[model samples]
Target: MKVVPSRSSEWVGPVTSQKRASAIIEIDRVSQVFQTSARKDHLALSNISLTIEEGAFVSILGPSGCGKSTLLYIVGGFVSPTSGAAKIKGQAITGPGPDRGPVFQEFALFPWKTVLGNVMYGPRQQGVRAAEAEAQSRALIEMVGLKGYESFYPKELSGGMKQRVALARTLAYHPEVLLMDEPFGALDAHTRTRLQNDLLNIWERDRKTVLFVTHSVDEAVFLSDKVVMMSKSPGCIREVIDIDLPRPRRRNELLLDPRYQKYIVNIERMFDESDEAGAPS
Candidate 1:
C-alpha cells in the first residue's frame, strides 16, 4: 500500500508530536560503588541525573578519577548501578545489550581477525550471515577512512587506525546509541584532531545518539551539542554547557571562537567551586 505524504509532517515520527525522538536514554539520581579491598565502600558516581535526546551528540567531561568512565559504563549497560536507574527509551537497563554500542579508549580489536572480520564479529554473533555482514562491515570501515586496510590485522595498524577498526565494529551492529569512552584519548595531537573531524562527519551522516566521555575541553566543545561537566571525588554533575556553535565545525575555526574559551573558563570555575580550593583567577 502506498502512503500519502502530509504537508505538516516532513520530519520523521508522529505528525502531531515532534519532540525530536523520545528521550532515548535517562539517568535518574544514579550512584555507583565498588567495594574496597579494605572491606569498605567507595562511591564512584553520586546521583548523576541526565537525559539524552535521541540523535543528540552529548559529551561528559571531567577531571581524572571523577567517575566519568564509570558513568559511561553504566549507560552502556556494562555495569549495574548501586542506586537509582538508567533507562533507555523508558525501559530500565539490566545488562549489556546490542542496542548500545561501546567504543573503548584501548581499541579492543581481535588480533587474529582481519579488520573486516573484526568488524563483522559482532553481527555474526547475533546470527547474521557472513556475506552480508562482511559487506556492511566493509562499508563502515570505508566510512571511517579505513577502506583499503580491511585485510590488515590489529597488530598491523597504527594506534589511530586500530581505533577506527574498533569504531567500525561498533557501527556494524547498527546500535541505536553510541557510547564512546575517550576513543581518541590515546592518539597523538595531530591524529586526534583528524579522528575528531572524521567522527563529526560520521555523526552528521548517521545522526545516532552519542554519549562521549573526554577530558579535553576542546574536544568536548567541538563534538557535542551539550557538554555535561562532572565534579571530582564521588562525582556528581556540576554543569551542562550548551554549545551554540554551528554544525560541521572545523577544528581551527571552532578553536578560534571566543565563545569556546569562555565556555572552557566557565567549566574550570565550576570545578573550582566544587572543590575546596578554587583556582586563583
Candidate 2:
C-alpha cells in the first residue's frame, strides 16, 4: 500500500488562551486484522496513518475490501485497531463516545421513529432535556432541508430523505467529529448527485470535521478538501490529494475538468495495481 504525506498541519484546534489545540482525529501506524478458523489471519488494514483537522472535510477512497469502512469505524471508536493508536483531539479513542457521530450507509433509522424523533434521539441520550432535544432536532432537520418531513416516519420517506434524517441525527449530537460510511451509496445516480451537493452545502454551512468513506471517486473529489486514496486489501493510504478546487462546485462542469479527471485516474490506477497484486499467483 502507498503512503500519503499529512496535510493536517494546517488544522488548528479550538482556540484557547493557553495551549493551541490539535487535530480532531489522528491515526498513526494503525494495523487491524481479524482471525478466522483456528489461526488464519486476515489483515484488513496495514500501517495506515493520517490526520484530520478540526472542521475539515476529508474522504477515504478505494475499491471494495480496502478496509475503508474499518478505518471509519476506528475513528468512530466502534472498533479498535490491532495496533497503533486512534486519537480524538489529544485523547485516545478506546470506545464510542458522543463526541463523535457516525452516519451509516444503510440509513439505520428506526422504522418506528418520526424524522424529528430520530433526530432528537442522540441529544436525548446525551442528557439534554426533551424540549431542548426537540428544538435542536427541528433546527437540524431544517438544516438538512428536511423541514416539512418532521412528522413523517422513516418508512414514509424516500431513501434520500431517510439518509437526510440519519445525517441530522448525527448533527444533533453536535459531535466534535463526524464519520460517514458511504452514506449515499444506495441512492440512484441522480439522487446520489443531489444528495452529494446537498451534503457539501450543509457541510460548508455547518463546518463540522467530517471523515467520509466511499468507493466513488467522484464523490470524494466533489465533497472533500482532501481525498485520501487507499490501496486494496490490507488497506493503506496511497495518496493524499489536495482538491484545491473551488467549493460549491457544480457536478457537470467539474467532472468535465481535466484536473478533476487526473485525480480520478490516479486513484483508479492505484486500485487497479492493488487488484493485480492481490490476484492469485
Candidate achieving the largest TM-score: 1
The runs of at least 3 residues in candidate 1 whose Cα sits more than 4 Å from the true structure, single-residue gaps closed, are 1-21, 273-281
lDDT, each prediction: 0.84, 0.83
lDDT of 1 by residue, 50-81 (tens): 87778888899999888999999998888999
lDDT of 2 by residue, 1-281 (tens): 11122345432122221212446778888999989788889999999888777777889998888899999999888999999999887899999999999999999998898999899988898899999899889988998899898999899899999999999998998887889999999999999988998888888776788899999988998888778888866678777776766656778888898867876776677678877887999
TM-score of each: 0.89, 0.88
**Model 2: runs farther than 4 Å from truth?**
1-22, 277-281
* Clashing residue pairs, backbone N/CA/C < 3 A, model 2: none
